[model samples]
Target: MTEVRGRMWVRGEPADGFTFSAISDCLTSEDTLVWADIYDPDHDTLTALAEELKLNMWAVEDATAPNERTKATVYRTHTFFTVYAIQMLTAVGDSTSTLVKHRISAFVLPRGLITVRLPPVAGDDPGFGMDEVSQRFDELGGQQYGVGALVHGLLDVVVDGHFDAVQDLDDGIESLEDELFDEDGPKRGLQRRTFRYRKDLVELRRVVLPMREVVSAIKSRRLDAKTSPELNPLYDDLYDHVLRASEWTESLRDMVTTVFETNLSLQDARLNTVMKKLTGWAAIIAVPTAITGFYGQNVEYPGLNTVAGFVVSSALIVLLVAVLYVMFRKRDWL
Candidate 1:
């Protein structure tokens, strides 16, 4: 189902009963700011809203396009952009962690902002909650600062979600680090989990890296002359957050790479240790084989077939084997 919720503020105070139909009329007032959120909008629903807002058709098409890259575009009438909200489900028991991304697109007009979410809907998920964005708007006095405030509130929520996803991935990486040095062997899932995290990080980096440009475009094209002075600092702060998240993701990619390489190195070291111990034991066993084989010779040397010869050979075998064992043990090869 297509669900659209609208909110308006008049001269810094929120007004009730705002709906999608009233958006055009409300935009006529200079003192008013409108925000409408449409959830899982169908093409028909989006087209209707686009006609009402007189939005650029190309921007509308971009919004509905499948797997659109995160970006911002400035048309003459409005600024359009898309961003993804991220969530990381940490590994549980034998399962590897998962990274989930939800798409949210926006049209920033001179007097208002409209957001469209594409889903696999997450019911009451704060990450995609219009109410949470609304509450953020209210808390920040968004109406007074113009559409920029609305944009900021929405992006703030998104960036925070990115931070959360990055943190969870970091925690997962730490757990994997602890498992890498196991004396027995790495866990069977170690490789699988590392690959999963690397894949997830790549996906996250794709979503996060573009956010820098997205925020910059909104600041330069939409906010500079139009929005209140107070909101600029907020955008600057928000931009910092975007940069930090982007940097954190890059660092995580490096960390996962390290974990993978370390796992291979540890395996090689264990293999070499096993080979050395085996070689040492084989050397010790060969002493008795050589001595007994000497005794098995048919021709008599001295005391052949005598008890004295048997005792002498057995003593020499035991003595040589014991010496080899002690030497190998001292060298930690056995």
Candidate 2:
């Protein structure tokens, strides 16, 4: 099983793991700043945290659920946020078929922050990069940073993930375009990939758009007094990042739609080409069919008795078909 525990960061230093009994001790510790990070804790641990931190039951429930929508909530003394971090795979083998997303729940209190990360399932570790943000927070000296800064740093990582996923999508689209236009290639695979990419973009937008509101709420300073005024700028910076990410997602969605439309148009053009070829052959054969039917009639006909007449009739039919074919070719309809 994946291990779960809480680590306390105080004034750029990490305290050993904090247990239930240690909670009050750590809370009373003489640290200018302290953060409690919980990694995939059990229900009991969540309950204890909820009680100790005075977090709303609903917020704790949402935190434990994996499919919770990206959102922000203001508790009596803390702000909670749920954010999604995306990881894209573009490998050529079995790895290529899998897409992984990491959903992280964050709780920001007046004196501390809590991050709960769920471990990846077997064969599906897309890996999270929370360490980088934690390191940066530590390096900056945690006391100087408020909960808003912590939230911003974490969100920055998440948005960076979005940027990387979008870049991967862009590269995938370019490859798909190449395959679609290749003269001797089959386009079905490219078309399928386009549809899949469009779906991915849609899902990405679903997760990202709500996050815009979450960041906006923080930047607007809607949180209670537990949130510091100095941290408003940090939230503002995060809001800008969310705006940029939203714009990028919209642009990518448009690009995916364009690719899908282009693929459909190509398919339609191909179908039309096939139909034209069949129609042209049918027209050519119709000329011979009519001539043979008329000449083969039982009644005495002007061209029926003479071999020369038969040859002339046949030549006329062939000549008519050849001329029609050339006309169609010149008109660019064949």
| Candidate that would win on TM-score | 1
Candidate 2 lDDT tens digits, 1-334: 3344445666645666666456556655546344555666788878886887678888888988867888888766778888888887765542133346788888776656678777765455756757776765655453444555666667777887887887787787778778777897555566657767777788888887888888776565543225356666666777777778788889888887887788789889988988988888788789889988888888986766899887999898989999989987886667
Model 1 clashing residue pairs (backbone):
none
| Worst ten in a row by lDDT for model 1 | 120-129
Pairs of residues clashing in candidate 2: none
lDDT of each: 0.86, 0.72
- Positional deviation of residue 276's Cα in model 2 after best superposition, in angstroms: 2.0
Q: Which tens-of-lDDT digit does each residue in 67-174 have in candidate 1?
A: 899999998888999999887654564445477788999999888889998765445443456677778887887578788888999999899999999999899899
